[model samples]
Target: IPHLLELMGFRSSAYLSHMRTLKTLEQIGAAASCRVGREDILYQFDVLREYVPVVLPLMLANVLCPSVLPEEVATAREHVLEVQQNIGENTESLLCELLHITAYRGNTL
Candidate 1:
């Protein structure tokens, strides 16, 4: 068990895998109109934003309650709706996919 733990130590394999793909793509001369190297960086940041809506419902429930002050509940509701609006920015075609991904792999995001 200790040997297995050492194999999966501090550095995560997923992050290493992502970096490996990015570097390998650049080394092999992948081309793009925009910067290809930046694509993965943007994706990493976008991922943080993309998962919010997926967990918002459960999060709000955990933090909120019918016993809480009415005003606090209202404020929390608005904040959640605002996040939903941001997720739906321009369009919400990806919302369903985000939900699916979160349901299947919430920890991964």
Candidate 2:
């Protein structure tokens, strides 16, 4: 999926956004596979988004197949760690809040 998106000339920002969606899909699939209740799954999904810009890829890694090529989970982990370190504590908190607000807005009509 990632490779195909890249080959089709998707920009990096677009690719990252799509990757985030893929991660969400994987989580929902995992929840379903485990026979989780629909309401519980939705709640968990909402909680998962709160950790966006930080732990998203780690959560995604739990659901992704290990044999997939290009190792996007690893890349995402590295990127997140880099951002966490470079931005330090205060900026990281602010960015997380901003990401949350943006995500909330995107989810709303």
Candidate 3:
């Protein structure tokens, strides 16, 4: 679910296709970013107060009506795989993941 939500802003409704979603946010000096927390996924945007009216709709549109293009999914998958590979190489991260696996066992953490 987090992986899917992470792509929410990769593209938006028809009017905001390709890179327009991100480009529009960039033009307004805004940024759309997300992270997976221990319990939930956080999707946030930063923009000037005056631009909330504009940014809010766009942000909502991205969340409610994402394009989720196949190319974007492929790219995201590759990126995730690369990050996992890197984590495997980092001892601290590997240990953390191992600890979670061991602690959770058959349960979701």
TM-scores, in order shown?
0.25, 0.23, 0.82
Q: What is the C-alpha lDDT of each candidate?
A: 0.37, 0.43, 0.73
Candidate 1 lDDT by residue in tens digits, 2-97: 222222221113223324433533554442121122113111111244545533432233223213344544555666566656766645545764
Candidate 1 TM-score, C-alpha based: 0.25
How well is each residue in 11-84 modelled by candidate 2, as lDDT tens digits?
Answer: 12322553554565566543212222312321123344444644355334434422233555456556666655
Tell me the alpha-carbon RMSD of every candidate: 19.4, 16.3, 2.3
The TM-score between candidate 2 and the true structure equals 0.23
Model 3 stretches astray by more than 4 angstroms: 1-10, 13-15
> Which residue pairs collide, candidate 1?
none
Worst 10 residues of 1 by lDDT: 38-47
What are the runs in model 2 whose C-alpha is more than 4 Å off?
A: 1-70, 89-109
Candidate 3: pairs in clash: none
Tens-place lDDT per residue, model 3, 35-65, is 7655787778888899899887786776677
Stronger candidate by TM-score (1 vs 2):
1
Residue-level lDDT for 43 in candidate 3: 72
Write the number of the candidate with greater lDDT, choosing between 1 and 2: 2
